[model samples]
Target chain A: MNDDVTIATAQQLIEFLGTFAFAISGIRHAAAKHFDWFGGYVCGIAVAIGGGTIRDVMLGATPFWMTNPIYIICTALALCMVILCSKRMERLQNAWFVFDTLGLALFTIAGIQKSLDYGQPFWVAIIMGCITGSAGGVIRDILLNNEPVILRKEIYAMASVAGGFVYWGLSELDVAIQLTALLSFVITCAIRFLAVRYHVSLPQLKTDDEINRVDNG
Target chain B: MNDDVTIATAQQLIEFLGTFAFAISGIRHAAAKHFDWFGGYVCGIAVAIGGGTIRDVMLGATPFWMTNPIYIICTALALCMVILCSKRMERLQNAWFVFDTLGLALFTIAGIQKSLDYGQPFWVAIIMGCITGSAGGVIRDILLNNEPVILRKEIYAMASVAGGFVYWGLSELDVAIQLTALLSFVITCAIRFLAVRYHVSLPQLKTDDEINRVDNG
Candidate 1:
């Protein structure tokens, strides 16, 4: 029981760090938009907490934030760090990207695990994982008055779904929990990083032909 | 069955109009934040669809907006209006408020009805109604870099909850569907209007003392 509790705590810590990194991304964007410190802080917190809140609400759980202040504190610390080290952080785009991808992988696995634990089917869990992985950034974009990066121009959610299938397959094979986590994480991060590298994405629905049709008609 | 089809068509129209109004609200906020027309359009569409998408996903249904293009067209129209009539809209606060509130009421009832149709309990239906009623605005606020008005000062969610209870009572008593709809609509709008008039709200959590402890210690 103690071992189980410790594992859970470690999982939560990884989640918090990911949430903080996610929040920092939003804060940086808000700062670029000339938002005040308060706005940056709020945006950061929203980006960190929004996805999980949506997932929890959908799953009929009290909001994850309501149960723990760690996420909140992580966001605050992220906010403070971003504000204090704005210039240095701005020069570390590659580092931030790596951190973001790692967070994305972790969040995807966490989402898939939670959905499976809830007794949802494999497909539902995969979709839920994608939603959990990408939603915070979606919320951030909407808040920042931009089109969601996920919806517009990224292979973001695709990576999450791909990772989710890997997770399901491994778990079904009765893989050890640590192995399952590592495999899912590697799959998600690799797919996301490669997609970013190759500029891979789903075709946008509004092709020039479609736009011309609407325009001409 | 003919009557049912007509009702369904009417419901579809209601959904479309609500989507338009809700999207316009998001567009207006985005415009105020100095987003370009495309950004405003996307934000509008997100705000319009976000709540319903959440409701649909939670119920394991296909997201209605993604299945239809009318919502996209409506959001585009809203964007055009905001861009072309920015000055005029700035003077139409009353009109915007009325439209926004009407959309809220309609969406609330629609959410309730849909959840009941899906065979959920009354409490769950009521919560769904509130989520549908308030979540778009919350998303808008998050995008606008503010704590949600509903969470901060609006008695917004309470009205939906009250209307939902009224819906439950009417359904239990075998009231005419139209009458029940009208009742929920009027009660929700009236309560919301009164609350806004009186600046009513739930007490906010006073986290200052807790934060002070964290800071000082």
Candidate 2:
């Protein structure tokens, strides 16, 4: 019982930190676009909870944010942080990267566990994990009117997928759930850090002319 | 019983036509981008069912398309139509406008009714109606890497909101459900048609410099 309580508390803490970090990321982007406070708050809330909301909706569960006001509060706090510390925040790119990766790792694990609890198969759970980690950023980019970075560059979602596979493999080998989550988080963060450090990215899709020719042929 | 059967048939037919029109719109846009056929199909499917899927997910219901493969089949048929009649389809702009308006109207009504059936308040239902009518296009634009036209150019979603209010008022006056739906649909389409014909639109958001000043102050 004590161990269960500890694990649950740890999970909750991770979720809270993840929410704050995601919100900060969104607000910082909105600041770059010079969106008004309301717009920034909307973006912050979206990037903080959008993925988990999508995951819950797809899994036929009530959206996690709708049930708790904390996420909104967290976003508001993030917006304030951006407004008050704009210069300092700009100088803290490394810290921002760490927080974003942390958020990504936690969200992916949370998604996988939720899917399993809902009786989804491993494949679906893995997809959900990637969605949870990445869809929020996609939504943020959409709102900011940018081509989604996930589709155009980076190995971000791939890292989430990798963590999901780690979770699946470890579970199959009868690992404890808490240990599995910890390892998955570590693996996800490690992959993202390494990929960014090495400037690794997926190949771009075929050019328009090439795609058109193929289609015509 | 006969009337009920007829209403059900009409609804289903509207859904089918709406799906087809929306998918065509998406695929045509994708083709312009010179996306591969598979990419076109993905875009088609996203615009065809994306709104309803969002509504269902928010309402904590299973996404409508998962249970019905007909929507996918409809999108496929739409892609084939686009491939075969590409030039003719471009010239049929008036016909496309009609079908798209019909879709917007029907989808708004359907969204309002579904939300009400799920025991949501009239206000929430109205918002859902607008979302259902307009969000698919937003998603399509995002995927195509354009700024959302709805946000920058048109009075599309507002028409849906207006229809939702009409539905609420007529229903409160004890109008029959079928008549309420029909009137709501007509109102939405009329507003949309008149707005486009008259070049009506909402103003753009504040400029970046203005927004930044507001934030700083």
Candidate 3:
């Protein structure tokens, strides 16, 4: 219902960077699936905005991206970047992983903070964080005809869940807003990094053999 | 924003039948994918109400299913039906096809009627009709890790678009709401029947073919 939504320059920059990083992941994934530039752009935009849009819908608020053209521009930029670096980016590891992790960590914090601002419960905030961190990848996988990583045994979403718990714990201990947020973000990033480096993943609900049997039967 | 979203008995019956059919389609598809029962139920509920939720979000309206408890119950009933005949239902083409087509026809009419009620343009109404009829199936396919059939070549969604045109035309000629809706529904159903019987399908965009090629390459 508000006519204008104003934010500080620093916050705007952070959001842009997060969106850019998320869009890059989407664009690259779409390209790997052999999608055209337009399809890649669509996937990039969807990955960049999908979770926030879902959260907005649940909150009964007009989606934030609808009013701001920045997200669209950022996604287009991501498509350009992917196209230009298609071969080189394919070889680089640290940069892609770092950007993706940054996006995840920032978006997880954003989701948790927004939920709290909306007066939602801790549990709701946790779920929101998970959705923000992984929903885009889920959507991308869907478009590519693959099982979503989150629906399997990925620890990516769990990192967000843990971040939410961190935020709540800090709040319970009367932590300052800036510091609490920083701690949560750090925790999310650290957990994600450790999981990837250590090859840690959650156990599947059913064994592969059992699943294959059901599928065949 | 209304306190009560009550409907006439006849309208309620139609909506329930449509939900039942869509949910059956969703559950059956999930079963074939070997998803767990919980996953199947989730897919069922999604297909039963996914299109309406998307339409409502676009219109900035609170999702209808979120308000009424009836939809959730109807989907549960559908799940029960599928579980009871999961074995036989897998081989029964007539039942699945009948339910899916009926749901598509009814949902297309609902989408157009709602869009017109919201005072959207004719083109917008047509797109809404297509979204309402086909978006659920798209989501179902996504969950099952398959490319959406509508995205490839199905006239299924085009049938809904044609129905929207028919509805608009009838309204311009001062047709009664009931008659225009009924006529649109019939035309949509007939077009779907012809398309399927004649093995008609649209050509894939070059984007898809090129993408597929790149993927295989």
Number of the top TM-score candidate: 2
Per-residue alpha-carbon lDDT of candidate 1 for residues A105-216, written as tens digits (9 for 90 to 100): 8888877777777766676677668768788887777767775666555777778878988988998899998888888989999998988898776543332233446768
Error of 3 at B133 (Å): 1.1
lDDT, each prediction: 0.78, 0.86, 0.78
Could you give the CAPRI-style class of model 1? Answer: incorrect
Q: lDDT (0-100) at residue A44 of candidate 3?
A: 91
Clashing pairs in 3: none
**Candidate 1 ranges with C-alpha deviation above 4 Å:** A1-13, A207-217, B1-217
What are the runs in model 3 whose C-alpha is more than 4 Å off?
Answer: A1-49, A57-130, A143-145, A152-217, B1-7, B35-42, B76-84, B143-145, B151-153, B197-217
lDDT of 2 by residue, B1-217 (tens): 9989998998888888888999999998899899999999999998889999889889887888899899999999999999888888878889878888899999999899888899887877886788788889878988888755665557788889899999999999999988999999999999999999998765433433555577799
Give fnat for candidates 1, 2 and onward, in order. Answer: 0.04, 0.18, 0.16
Displacement of residue A173 (Cα, Å) in model 1 is 2.9
| Cα deviation of A113, candidate 1, in Å | 1.6
**Candidates ranked by TM-score, best first?**
2, 3, 1
